[model samples]
Target: MSVFIEKKKRLSNDSISQLEDELEDNPLDYNKWIKLIKQVMVKDKEEQIRNVFTKYLDIFKLDGEQWCKYINFEIGKGDFKKVEELFAKCITTVDNVELFRLYVSYVRRVNDVITGGEKARSTVISAFEFSVNRVGIDVKSGELWNDYSEFLKSWTPSQSWEKQQKIDLIRKLYKKLLVIPTEKVESMWSTYTKWENEVNSSTASRFIADKSAEFMEARAWNIEWNNITDKSLSRKVLPYGLDDSDKDNRKEIEQQLQYWYKWIEFESRNNLNLKDDDLLNKRIEYVYKQAIVSLPFVPELWYRYNQFLMNGPSTEDSNSLNMNIDILSQGLILNPKSYLLSFQLSELYEKETNLAKANEVINNLVNKLIQDHSQIIKQIEEINDKSIVKTQNINGDADNMDEDDVNKPKPGYFLSEHDIKSLKDLKLTEKELSRNITLVYTKLMMTNKRSSGIKESRQIFKQAKKFANIGFELYVENALMEYYSDNKKTANKVFELGLKTYGTNGKYLLAYLDYLIMVNEIESIKVLFEVSITNLLKEIEDPEGVDDMDTPVWIKNENLEKINNHKYFIKRLIKKYGKFATKFLDLGIVTSLEKRFKKYFPEDDELELFRSRYSYDSIDLIKYDLGKSVKYIEQDTRGDIDQFFDYDDETFDKNKRRKLDLPSKPKETAVANQPVIETQNGFIGESIYNLLRILPSASYYGNVEDHVFNSKKLVELFNSLDDIRNQ
Candidate 1:
């Protein structure tokens, strides 16, 4: 044993040395740095651990996990002052709920050790105040508040004045916590009421008066909560924590149901009188009805609705019972495979002293499931036989026919032989249908309360395993059933089988990951992460290709969908694990994956703009008004021209008019000598002679006299043309 330990220690030291050398060359390798820190931690050398963490954090200050580990290490050393100092630094550095939670937990531990001393009390109080200020608005702040209240409750003041002060502070804290819109609002209120009840027993009238005001405040706050939820619902705002990018309408509706459920619970807990009870019941029913309308197939809502009716004041009424039955019937009709409602119906019948009816319901359900299962099996056999016979016939026909004859066009629609064959293959195969039937049978048997339900369920599970093409959902269900039945080892084995079978599938891998997380199997999580990332990348690399001509439209679409789902899963993994996902992040693959994500699941406009700034051209100039008009000129017409002239008419007088000293009378030429008639089109065209003139020195100049002469000559020329035209 000592030799083995020495060998393991040597290996650890060697690994640390290698990582240190690697880090010296590539200092920013996050994983290498983390590995070195973990190696140092295993040695339990406080100074070495501190130095390594300090060095890594000095370079990578934003690493929350490293900061947390540093603080936790100090905490483990039981050095409260150092822990506090570390927390103070970390709270400023990392804006995370986990850090605040750790601080609160540390303060609570210190207070427990020191009991009621002034210093300990002040320290705990100040820490609680700081945590509340830091993370009060977080959804999980309820835990912090609960811990604070518990800490305050544990304080035992020696004097009456001190006790009063403590009570006042606790009440103030509770009042503040009550107003926050957290999912745990109800729990906070419950704690506050319990505290108030204890105070009321001690000082009756004073406590009542104080609580009257607090209760009023709480009532107002609850009304505010109602208004906020109503407005959000009206605006179609998704519930907090649900991903809007997923575009899952059912999930959004289900989240809304959660909100409604909480609201109903709040109202039920706060009802004080007949009027309040009536109002609360009415609101609950309205919300329940609304939820069911949107999510008719959700069995939980139906179950809740039925429970509410049964537990209400009308429970003794036969009509109320009938109403519950009717709701369950509707739920069962909408979701025939929902064993929950079926079991509930049977239980209700038994509660009413109708064991016969209860048994009848269970037996009928079991018989129907068994009959369906048998029929499916028979159909599968028939399909197999038909397929075999058909294949043999095709083989025989092919053998008898020549190649040309075999290739000859068959009399059919526009589909080619390959397309027809693909279409024929698109249906769910016999094996798949058989597995689905077995799954349904297993579910029914599991829900049934008969003597042989467990035995039958196990048998169905075994039968399901016989089919090679069983769905991932079936495997998951079987594993979960085993886990719930306390057969955890078997459940784990089932999950292993599933991973072995569908290792390339993200759905099964993610389901298994979730189960591991739930079970806190950290080592298995790491191993699975490594395996899943490699397999997922390979699947993304070599996706199934569907030939456009031969593949059915649905099959092609399903393949495309699978590819997109793989991309989404990869992105989700990166987001969940951050630097741990580095092993999977080949630069090429990441770039392509990001492009695919952007194409399929685009972010909001602002986010996309920020991300795509370097990749695409920006809209530097956005026009908000009508743009300038385009000028269209005729081919022979001159384009728009602005004319400018100098005023020098005297230049025209110095230049002799170079009149074409032609014949005095009109002469015919090859070109028609149309009379020089000027049309007054819009503004009359300015004569070139008036605009400029030739000086006696043979330079062009314009003066006032020249302008006047050209203007008078143009008028006379026009008058002469008009008179000649009239003649």
Candidate 2:
């Protein structure tokens, strides 16, 4: 409540009021009066001042700066009408044609935001008319003409407008300036072209092109020819008798030639709606002419010409093919080591499937290697003699060997692993084809006993593995060879070792998984499953080092910060295998089968039986359970229990039915009439094996029940057996 002191700034309202009265009579006194009026008006008086300005819009001839000030201030107030009025007043100012255009443009821009119809259209049209007729204006004022034209176009059309009428309007506006000074026309042509392109109407582009051509021609052709070709100005001549000072002139002509050549190339490439025969003929002629004109001896053009003639009706004309080959040969002579020419000749022969000549070229390359590695060949031949001696002792005389004996190679003694590796490197030394060598190794394995040697197998695996490193398909075959040669357990161990060493890179990951599945290595399969799941979780959560999410198997992560900070890993786990795999795990189906097989078939060697030849209907599981339960019946007997345990396709008891039809049998006799049983361990084991033979392959994995709808048959079969026991 203490006394509040206020300091006041002095103002001359009396002077401002007098000037305002003068402005009211003739508001065009903008330069002398407007700035002073604005200085005295407080922020609160903005609306009152805007009202006065709007009322006097027609009478004012404000300078562009003062007028622009009012328009911008009014726009900030959202009083678009006042902005348009002030903009109109500004453009009508006599001087500062550039400023007039700039202010008018600002007005149209604001009008576009808030006004439509005849008011906006007429305002823009007025600006265009002023800009086109103005002299000594900024070059960019012509650009304002374009903006005004667009604003006028947006008006609701009169009923008189036809397709051609709208086109002519744009044409007439553009043509008005077409006859303007050439320098100005040239400067404005680019702006006009830009405006013309933005218009969607079809006729606009053609109209712009015609007008631009007219403007360029007026500027370019108006000069006398001697101005461009005055070569007497040169100071010296080069050895070719061309003037050094005229170099720039010659370059200009060359540029023109290049420009025309580019257009020809474009037309030839697009061929838009041209007829097939015409297009072909036109393209061929262009290529042929281009070859003759530019660097006349270029080889690519010659090849293209040859391709065209052969592809056309003149293919049978051997003359053109021979001519192209001659050109290629000449080029080769100049550039002797050109790989492209050599490859082309090889391809031409190969395309005809003329393998003999292809072999001849390939053999020449291989023969060079043989000459270089004569010592290695001698050692390889000596190794073969030792292998043949060992094989001959095993098979008795070689003459009586199996029919496939001819397919077997005479075995070579690889005295050491180094010898095999040395032979493999010989091909690379002479630059012989490596891929064909892999194929040859494949044939040697299939056809020759020499392939059975352990050192030799290791050597082949090494070469195949090298090719696989480069992504060849032959590595899978080599992995299969290693798999089949050993105890199944050892093969699984080797592959597992390989996987650990290889880091489970994606390509090798797929190959390794495929091999495990083929050989029924379930334990290794489970390990891989865990590895893949862990990889998915780490990638989805932190994603720091994962590569190439573009692979089809991967999905890119969005929302990096959220993914890293949150636990979205469970969702990733569910997504990886889909719901079905999760369901199997949750229901304990997989665990139960693994446990049951190991428990009941403890000593069985055919652990892979579950995976082999497994086909069954829903009823088969019941039969399997019945077969397993009755297996014990043969175990406690002493007579040959083999028949009881030995199973095959189920047979009906024909003799039992025949006896029933004949007469009723006494109980004592029936008990005594049962067949004698056997009890030796070997006999019992053999019978158990026989029983297994008839049980479909699936009975091995406890998958028998899955074959019958999640073991519904097992339940039924168990219940029926319990009923019989109770009776």
Candidate 3:
């Protein structure tokens, strides 16, 4: 080998040694031992391989994979005696069906290769017998039985008497397998029938009798399969093997149901020609009925039963419809509160156009709701009475007690007090219950076609209002009915009632506003908008007061909903009215509201943006005062005039000593003319300079007069002044 190959081999050997050391410390490391054995096998170390297999099997004897590796290794060595020995040992140590299978396969190979006559045949039969004894009772041991029967078929006898004996033995094994309740029992029966037909071709009478018996036995096997599955369903577990504690029991039951379903499907698939279609459907229906009878509380089984009935051959028959109805009705009796069963019943009635029955079912449900609501109200009243009594007792006791006794800290006082307060507050009032009951009653009456006229509907609304004076939904529903009936005036009245009762309700506010908008009532729309904005802001400001009448547990959630509703309404108004919405944005109130909202709800980005959109800067307009006179013009002009006076050059140098003061007229004339000319020029220059300065800085203001116009005018004035000064 090359030097590199030698190095690679040495490294693999080193790794094998390290792994072996690890296995010595932790012999249960099955994977490491497997890896080490693989490495040793690569080096072709026969003795090391044997030693590794021996050690691993001795440690992990119950592990099927280890036994398989050992058996496979022994078989590869072509040592029949060693393979047989390993099979015997594995069968005793491992309780795995695959190991038994491997053992049977090895025995068959040996019989084929060595042709050990009766001795090898006996070995194979013994292997089969051992496996049968070990795993024959397991429901999943169909493969083992299959392999055994196939092995017997593959084995041939040398003498006629021996052939008869072998045939009898195979028949006996088949009969024995027939008693085991497994999914593959039917296939086994088929196999047995085929074998008997080939074997007894000459004995016609005996073959017919035997086939008839086998057919009876097959029917018995089917019944036994049903019984086995039924028992498993009853136990809520699998029929064979150790129960898996980690698996869900419900899933196990579902799996058992699926098994039966599959068995029925198998019978249907295979016996299509042999069995009558009606008989097959009846058999499947019988099994489904048995299942529902056993697990009537399971809605899934009921649904499956309904599906079977609907899709069955008799689906269009009257009896099938009645049967489906009876099944669902029975299911409802088992679980009266099951909405699925109730809905199914309603659908069945509607399908048949049994309007009376459908109405009756709906009436029953409505009555149930009313009774439930009444019971709840009574319970709430009892709790409130108890709370009131407790409060009275506490107050009376406090009055009789000393100051210290009354003020002393008590354990659980806060918790008990809170519980009492919650019990008192968390109740649907009589008005609320009456409101719901009225709506349900109206629905029941209308559903039966007993009340169809507008007058009847109006009477129903009036009765509902009498019961619940301030029910918001009742008001809205009444208004909607009137509006839909073209009773516009009544609808407006109902809407106003709803607004008066539930001013903070965004739905009512929006509905009334929409109606106003539809009527072209702009003033009413404005009023509604203002009222909604005020109520929403008020609710947000004092959420505690707003939610006091609601459930205490939902107070925070109600507050959040109110904030969201506020945001929603504000956005709607802005989207609909645009500039008209600016009238609602009060700076002082909104700023304070924003501060409070931030303190309580800092994460409300929508509300934050709403606040920022209407802040002072967002609305304030900037004005530039370019028309104002300049302040420093007089001072600049005086400095320019003084510069003109301070001038005098060579002529002044000669006249400086002539009189030390020139003639008064010339001096006065010079002074007079200089002031006039310089002052005029200075004023024009200052005006142009100031206008240029103002033009650049004018953009700081929000509404500077048109820049283009100002620029043109200033340029024109400056050019005219320049022309005048040049002349």
TM-score of 3: 0.39
Give candidate 1 misplaced runs (Cα > 4 Å): 1-309, 312-343, 347-397, 400-460, 463-470, 477-486, 520-523, 547-555, 574-727
Model 2: number of backbone collisions = 10
lDDT (Cα, tens digit) per residue for candidate 1, span 222-268: 55666746644421222222222446855776557766676567556
Candidate 3 collision pairs: none
Q: Note the Cα lDDT for every prediction shown.
A: 0.61, 0.45, 0.60
Error of 1 at 467 (Å): 7.9
C-alpha lDDT of residue 342 in model 3:
62
Q: After superposition on all CA atoms, what RMSD does each candidate show versus the true structure? A: 34.8, 36.0, 33.1
Give the winner by TM-score: 2 or 3.
3
Residue 377 alpha-carbon offset, candidate 1, angstroms? 12
What RMSD value applies to candidate 1?
34.8
Cα TM-score of candidate 1: 0.30
lDDT of 3: 0.60
TM values, all candidates? 0.30, 0.21, 0.39
- Model 1 clash count equals 7
